[model samples]
Target: MLSALQLHSRGWRVSVFDSGSAGRESSWAGGGILSPILPWNYPEAVWQLSRRSLPLYDALAPELAEATGVDPELTASGAMLLDPDQIQAGAAWCAAAGLAAPEIDAILQTRGPSLPGLLLPWIGQIRNPRLGQALRLRLRQLGIALHENTPVTGWLRDGGRVAGVDTAAGEHRGDCVVLAAGAWSGALGALPVAPVRGQMLLLRAAPGRLKRIVLDGGRYLIPRRDGRILVGSTVESAGFDKRVTGAAREELLAFAVGLLGTEAAGQVETQWSGLRPGSADGIPYIGEHPALPGLWVNTGHYRNGLVMAPASAELLADLMEGKPTQLDAAAYRLGAGRL
Candidate 1:
């Protein structure tokens, strides 16, 4: 949808085809941390895309809310990293990236005292489901053709140069075709994308119980505006299985309770899972395909889809238009080393 919106805004006729309902897939299920969970852990490419995309939301959130009457709840609530070991590296990364240095703190009144953690006050988050809702509405408002519940069966090939997609309803021909199918991109072609299931649990807590996003180890606690705390997530290699297992529920609930104390033990509201497009490395492919002319790709975003969406869309648009890109487009090309 971001890609479609980007193209549409640039005076191009755009149509979005989804196998299921728009915004009900990975975009809705994500935790919506605007920045990478652990920026120090990801590659330079991931950070490059994230750094460029993060500021775009400051304007986008309000634009969506004003246009669609659905607030995405973009918040600068900041983030607390409990990993004391990464403080030095995190500080260095912040310095290099021109971001404010993290403040060293030992105690969060809500979660109690612990080893001193890094408090980054600039980190932002969005209510992801609401963002998805706003995007869908905005797409409609812009008069972009949105074909929901329509699965593209295959490519409408024109000899070597591609033309458009083949759908069950009929043939929807276009001058260019972009594969932005997320985890399902692997099934369509020789792409290196696959489904990696991640399960998340939501706990109904007091609105003020948890103030900031907390990251401990690989898991996180994202407190929403409506007193709902999102506890996520387990990274399992289980292919395409979005089942919310009891084990994952227990594990995520335990993690929530462990951080927020015993009062959070029975606050479980709901549990769900999403399939992220897992690539070998975290960097997504955001350029034209070398083998198929006029066939572009914007999949393989793995875990950072929401974080990198805006810049990814812009970068893909730049490549498609043969314009100078903001970041080095070579890093995200199809034949680039890591998919």
Candidate 2:
């Protein structure tokens, strides 16, 4: 949506396509964790992107809220990681990567409080459903064409250049085509993307269950302003089956229960799943095809699609406009995995 807004603002006619309702996929389902709760594990480029994007939330959130009449609730609530081993490794990686490691408050130990958690002081989060709602409303205000419930069957190309897409209704022609189709991105004819499913459970937080986001190994407990503490995200290669299974739910429950005290575990309200586009490499595919002409891609964000959305739009729009990009957008190209 930010990409569409950026491009449309540049006087380009932009159109977005989605199989379900717009922004109903992983983009909407995410817990909106920005920056590394364990940022040290990933490459420095991702952190750099968040550093650029994290500031924009303040400006973008209010502007989007005013324009769309929906506040995305972009909050600067920090994240806590309870892995001492990962923290040590993360500090070493930060120094090796030529980045500054955030200061740690080691004195905050409270009579050996459960376990000493490393606090990522610069992280941010957004309410994803609200972000999606606001993005859609903003796009509508801009007169950008939104083709929801319209799945692209294939790409229509002529002489190596992409002309448009072959959809269920008809072909929509464009001088330049940008595929921001989220998780279903790879399977679109020549695009080499596979859908990865994630099962997440949403629980209403009891009073003061958790103040900040808690990362305990595989399970993350994200608390929202409206009292919905989202416990998520099981990474399974179930091939686009966006259905929550009993096994996955039970696993999340067990993990979450271990993290929280006895009473907080009982407040788990609902469970659901959302599919994310995953590549063999965990990095997202976000550049133009090497061979295809007049075409671009912005998919394969893994689970960070929501967090990366704002920055991606700015970068992609810069590429489309033939202007200088902030990051080396070409780094995220579809190399051997070209569809």
Off by over 4 Å in 1: 105-114, 336-339
RMSD (CA, Å), candidate 1 to true, equals: 1.5
TM-score, prediction 2: 0.91
- Residue pairs with backbone overlap in model 1: none
The lowest-lDDT stretch of 10 consecutive residues in candidate 2 is 103-112
- Encode model 1's per-residue lDDT on 210-305: one tens digit a residue: 889998878999999988999989898888888899999998888888888888988888999999998888889888888788789999898989
Question: Best by TM-score, which number?
Answer: 1
Q: Estimate each model's TM-score.
A: 0.97, 0.91
RMSD of each: 1.5, 2.4
Looking at model 2, the pairs that clash are 36-39, 186-193, 190-339
Q: Report the lDDT tens digits of candidate 2 across residue range 1-339.
A: 778888888889889877779878887777788764576666655665666676667789999988878999988676776776786776576577555546545625321565566665556689988998999999988899998898888778877789998898899988888887877777663566678888888887754556677777767888888777888878888886777899988888887777775665677788888888776555666667666777788777776777777777787778777789888865576776434
